[model samples]
Target: MTGGTYTLLVEVPEATTISVGALGDQQFPAGWYAYTGSALGTGGFGRVDRHYELAAGDRETRHWHIDYLLGHPESRIRGDVRTPDSDIECAVASGLPEGPVDGFGASDCDCESHLAYAETGAELQTAVADAHRQARSE
Candidate 1:
């Protein structure tokens, strides 16, 4: 679907630090991350597909903070939780636990950070999916 909010579930196999554009260097522990974002622009959810491409090493241009993490060969997109036709990016993000980075994926908004992290993939995925469902229900 188009024009919605989504949370990308990403996995980093090993701990490493990457420099996010303008955000400076940040350390990412090997685990799972849930990044929430909005797709309300002209292209809508096409942005999500582009993210997948970046994770797959098919795209090189880093347009967003998430791009930097996804670009790492060891980091990959595992899945996504979407709320089609919904505009609850902040709500969903707020519901998730705090992330290591202070402003990851939240340059345009006031969220502490749109990315949340967990020690395991299952924990992060459950939290991300539940957050989206809770936000959409509200």
Candidate 2:
């Protein structure tokens, strides 16, 4: 619907926040999070970025709802990239996170739209193992 940069920002479990440029300024708290959707929404990048901004005067930034609900466990942001082409959305739908996304449903990139999601510690580890298994099979 608009010409702009679109990217996904995921919060790695108590580790680090991985930003693909769509979300800016604010940082993601230590936890798993996946944001997929329009970067052109109101407040745009600021809205999503603020998700990680620890409340003023707070020791930890885990005061947000997502963080509180997740119980601040160790995890990582796990995801893959692809151009938004024919059937790309359907292909990535299964890759989305298990929770609600604070923004739109897809990211508009140069080659195509991209999708991403976060995973818990165990989930991240399992995904890694699965990748290895697939690699070995190949």
Candidate 3:
């Protein structure tokens, strides 16, 4: 396994299309996330924190399919960092030191790092939008 982990921001009540089989009922309305067991850049925790801090700004808002499933009002983060063993995480670990991530929305591109420093509500919205756009495109 690779020495990497994924941080994800999922919306509550949203169903994530993670290759980890099925989320079942443990769905999140809206929040940041990092899949467990995957190598991450310098500020892995900081990046995910930006997606949660309410003051992160609007740019970090939710927009991906999982976020859409979560919808509005659910953007409020509801849980702590969760680590699950899934195919997605496993895949990510397989390719460490690659600089870019495979299953991650903002993998190796700008989209992935732009939200690393969500400091205001507006920035959060924009960051979320960026991830959402990336998710949709993929």
Lowest lDDT 10-mer window, candidate 2? 80-89
Of candidates 3 and 2, the better by lDDT: 2
Q: Write the per-residue lDDT of candidate 1 for residues 15-99, one digit (tens) a residue.
A: 9999999999999998999999999998999999999999998999999999999998889899998889999999999999999
Candidate ranking under TM-score, highest first, comes to 1, 3, 2
- Model 3: CA > 4 A from native: 1-39, 54-71, 82-88, 91-138
The TM-score values for the models, in the order shown, are: 0.97, 0.28, 0.29
Candidate maximizing lDDT: 1
* Per-residue C-alpha lDDT of model 2 across residues 1-138, encoded as one tens digit per residue: 221222233445444433323432224445544433323444544533443342222234443333332223333223322222122332333344343333323333332222334445455334433433443343
Model 2 regions lying over 4 Å from their true place: 1-39, 55-138
Q: How close to the true structure is residue 66 of candidate 3, measured as C-alpha lDDT?
A: 30
The list of candidate 1 runs beyond 4 A from truth reads none
- Put down candidate 3 lDDT per residue, 31-103, tens digits, no spaces: 3432222235555445445444532344435533233222334344433322322223433322222212233
Better of 2 and 3 by TM-score: 3
Error of 2 at 93 (Å): 4.1
lDDT of all predictions, in order shown?
Answer: 0.92, 0.35, 0.34
